[model samples]
Target: MAMVITVAIAVATELAIVGAGPAGMAAAEVAAGHGVEVTLVDEQAVPGGQFLRQPPPQFGVSDWLGDPVYREGRRLLERVSADRRLEWIMRSSVAGIFSNGDDDGDEPFTLVLNPVGEGDSGEGGAPRQLSARRVLIASGCFDLPVAFPGWTLPGVMAAGGIQAFVKSQQLVPGKRFLFAGSHPLQLVVADQIVQAGGSVAGVLFAQSSSRALALLKHPSVLLGNADKLSQTAGILWRLRRAGVPVRFRQTVLSANGTDSLESVTTVPVGPDGAIDSDAAEEIECDRLGVCFAFSTSSELARQAGVDCRWDASRGGWIAKHDDNMASSVPGVFVAGETTGVAGSDIAALEGQVAAIGCAAELGKIDARQAVELARLPRRQLSRRARFARLLSELAWPGASLFDQLMSDSATLCKCEGLTVGMLRTQLGRHPDIRTASAAKLLSRAGMGLCQGRYCHFALTRLMARQLGVPEERVGGFTSRFPAKPVSIGRLIGDDS
Candidate 1:
């Protein structure tokens, strides 16, 4: 195997964090406070990640949509900024991670960083290299795509995508909107739109109110998360006061438009989870927002040869981590969504735990001290994780929802323009192709710019349903280095 070429150009640090989101920022703060030299890197120009994405500095927008979480994020960003030992690499992405140690021992991790905007004057925008004794992966999660008829319409977008535009850029996706998704986060997004002076036509929640209320069965979990409950309830109240129709057990069956999204068809889901087509209703709207759940952005962890397994509650395959957030790799640690689909609170705690683990492993803190430092965070993590599990169960998409929404003509792989009919036909013609990876080889389903991030979960479910197997049997595609596309010039180095 090719090894990470360590040259003089590479900067060295005691700890290197791949993402500057909540988990990463928290991890950097803790490590730096403990006198460790740390480097924090993120793709965005800001540090808040997706959950707490901030408006651009020039936007002059002081209102954080009346959400307290954003205020907390601002404070976290300030703390990260004031840390003298923490180095911030903004507007850049980690192109690849290279290390070789299967036989010899743990090797120093070398990360290739590619600038996001404005090409550096050099061959392939010559990437900078960072070598670290210990690495933490907190790459976070992305919006899960739901494939349905007319979903490729110009005005249709993922709910989280719409929120990102509204929150980070202060740009509304459309004048009038309809939100349909499995998670309650969609309602939160709708609240944002309304708060931003935009109109929402309606909100369709896939899970019924009774199903959601079932979470209350774990009273301690619900009571422990009283703050989150209050926030959610407040958002719901605002939507109600704004006259936004929030309907439960309803999902968008299709989107329709000639040039852009003009209307959407929705149907009530019965107790059995099948769409009650007899009660289908068509509502006109300029834009449609849809999402089911989120999948962990674990490409970097996978690239590092970390062990992973299919986790349904987490939305897909996740890197395996222990109580200390240490991954299968000796010197590499993982936290936040990269490990699983827990929310931002759990992610922050995980980061602190990972930092403690790293400090102890590096001899900066003794084992006893590390254990003492990790005790409270570990307890908090367990409590939050239990509540997260309840939330996941409540928001879990019904298998029948996919069957009702996705038609044979609906596009599955947007990057390759592959439709459901095309995929089904391919599977029928080749019975031997059972797994998603095998289907990718035959049909090019996931061989596009996204590298299957958008279509992997949907494709896996489709394949599993067709083959009468569990979703786990149809595994995800094997991730490769430079997970996202980078200029060829960067890969070859700046010879000029």
Candidate 2:
């Protein structure tokens, strides 16, 4: 083979952290411990994720805003902050994932991040691109709530976004709410809202208790961490004790109100996992907190062209990885929820494992010692994986949920203002429309108001079903420069 040479060199100086969440912070902590210089970057100004959301200005340091996972995340970031080699860049988001060459060493890969104030400047005020012997992506998960007829109403929101609102701004999305979802996240947010003095009509599960219990029957899950098991039990108990109705095997078919959400029409799913319209019931609530589940935030990973898989058991399509937490793309390693559905603690462990693996790959650590060091985190991760699988199965998005709202007009691609009928036609015309990229190109399905955040999952599932690939294998959209919406003038490098 002829040796290929390329001029595209990724600037190498220090290890770059793509996120400042639990996973990123943990990776930086372990990597720094191993004497590797680390740079941590994130869209948020703080370390804790949307879960351990930062307190408002009104609160100094209140128990009003802390969780075990969050406390652990803060401690890890604190340790990383103390390290002289670590750099924490807040209010920065990853813009692009570029590989100048292949694994043949003809080209190198670089991660580009745009700071909040500094816009697009290929040179001046351009994003800081760090070349590294190894890179860890712990970007975390993004939820996709299938849109209903009245979902665009002012008060309706994703269960996760509502939680973020409370955590960040101390703002309640609505005074009266009905949280409808099965995941542990739904309950977590419901409790947060109630604790904040908001009235929650009920918390409903689209999946049946039998389904959830069936997942718990997995022997690996049964033997998983006692803390998580106990925590789940406590949440269920609290819901029951508080007289909060927990409905199961129910789906919120539609929300109806003039300008805002007023009530939702929910229906029951039968034994064959089909929704029965005749069993519909109208529940009055100010807000509908809805989300099926979440998958890895693959914006950066996909841009780098890392292979992904639709492991429903791991929370939809996720980046593929080996025991070392390294992706198929050699130096590009993935940690945390970006890889799978393991909780924050598991993500932290995976981040540490990636750091250890990175150190060995960079020849900073002896292979023999790396092997020994990898065991503890791996064992802990195995336990968490067991629980994660159980949780995924317990809350898997059922096909019938879509069938319940399968309308010719029900908006599927909210970003592009696209409906199911339009997407179907576009898919037929462009048989190659098998990924978020294709959808964006053909029908502009992900190019509307929310910028594909709401429609990406539906596009993935629809395309996967059409192409006969696992949902995760369907691929995702490539994140471009100005990760978030930025002014063109700002992108053109003008502060004033």
Candidate 3:
């Protein structure tokens, strides 16, 4: 069920799945049911992806959140692990996906994999490769990096990153945490921190509660998600009892401290997401959790030459998938947040539909059977999509908010230590710097270690706002191969 294939030779398979998240797990299960062979590659040691992120074995964590919140994920993981046909290549990342044949040829996909923690030393291990007849990418999303002043400080981190620490490390990494974001995930993280005997200074929402809560009035959004609704109510009730302030129409204007986060200034944001700087309040806290938005982890998809369309509401560029979740590229399928940032429930639904489509295409099942198998998941996905849309609408801090938060001195690209002032100077010189790619060349904003993951959106926002064009015209970075950083040694090993 699992392996650490250290060989440089590529192990060919019928289907290769990327990511071991909810969508990937679901697809593996469905693919197995169809008697299809699958090789799933994930960066985590465990099967669960971010949503079901687990504590490392050394942590000795056994409590499963003490709720049914993770029960389904646990079950899914158990089922996937029990299947012998589904092979898991854990603790490894697909550095790049190369077509094994000509551009027009339909040859297998060659995946260059680097051991997750193994440095390029070529001492611990060599870079490996996996070959698959067809590929499915379900790489999820990550916290949207919005650079306000002091966000690059040591103690200032994304809410999701903080939550990942709590979930995967069994350690609350901070004290006196102040959460400022429009995403509801922040509430879950706050509750987790509070339950772990940590202090929550407060949780702030930029949008007023009434506007977001109005969507709950819809019966469709409320139905079939009782467990989730109950869990939310419990979290809210516990936070209230803990005397943690949950404020609305508030946003973190800027963080304060020279070396680490000591406090953050909060100000009331208008419906337009512009802050009223006069009504600012400075709150003392060691940790600042910013959860404004999430961007699709589509770097690999883009590198694989798949089509992506920009939709800020869906989280930057989303892979273009047909109804069956097959991407524009032949034999390349996509699901979950890579398609767009709906919830995990919808992710599983999309995974099921995608797996069924894969099964049909592989001749493992008949088209009629595939249609019937996909019907229920598709129906459920439609319902879940509605609720997710409502939630996304509520969580999206208006596009203007990024420009307003980006002060001249704020670090736009943390990796390169590039600031807004530096970017503006480059724009003044270039005059034609209208896209992230161009800006990256002119200002070196996106050429950092993160490859513009942290600064591309902000840079695009800066360019679009300055040029008075949509962020679409101010396009995202041109994705390149070796999507993640790889050692020169590994590249040599892959080549040799």
RMSD for each of the candidates = 3.1, 5.0, 3.9
- Specify the highest-TM-score model's number: 3
Candidate 1 local Cα displacement, residue 208, angstroms:
1.6
Off by over 4 Å in 2: 1-12, 56-58, 65-71, 81-85, 100-109, 117-126, 213-226, 428-436, 449-451, 464-475, 478-496
Rank order (by lDDT, best first): 3, 1, 2
26-123 per-residue lDDT for model 1 (tens digits):
89988877777889889989888887787887788756644554555567777887777778888878877777444334337888887777554333
Model 3, residue pairs in steric clash: none
Residue-level error in angstroms, candidate 1, position 103: 9.4
Q: Any residue pairs clashing in model 2, and if so which? A: 11-131, 101-107, 310-472, 317-472, 415-448
lDDT of each: 0.81, 0.70, 0.83
Output the worst ten-in-a-row residue range by lDDT, candidate 1: 216-225
Regions of candidate 1 where Cα sits further than 4 Å from its true position: 1-9, 102-107, 119-124, 213-226, 494-496
Per residue, candidate 3 scores C-alpha lDDT tens digits across 13-90 of 777899999899999999988988899999989888888888776777768655666677778877887888788899
Tell me model 3's lDDT, rounded to 2 decimals: 0.83
Could you tell me the TM-score of candidate 1?
Answer: 0.93
TM-score winner between candidates 2 and 3: 3
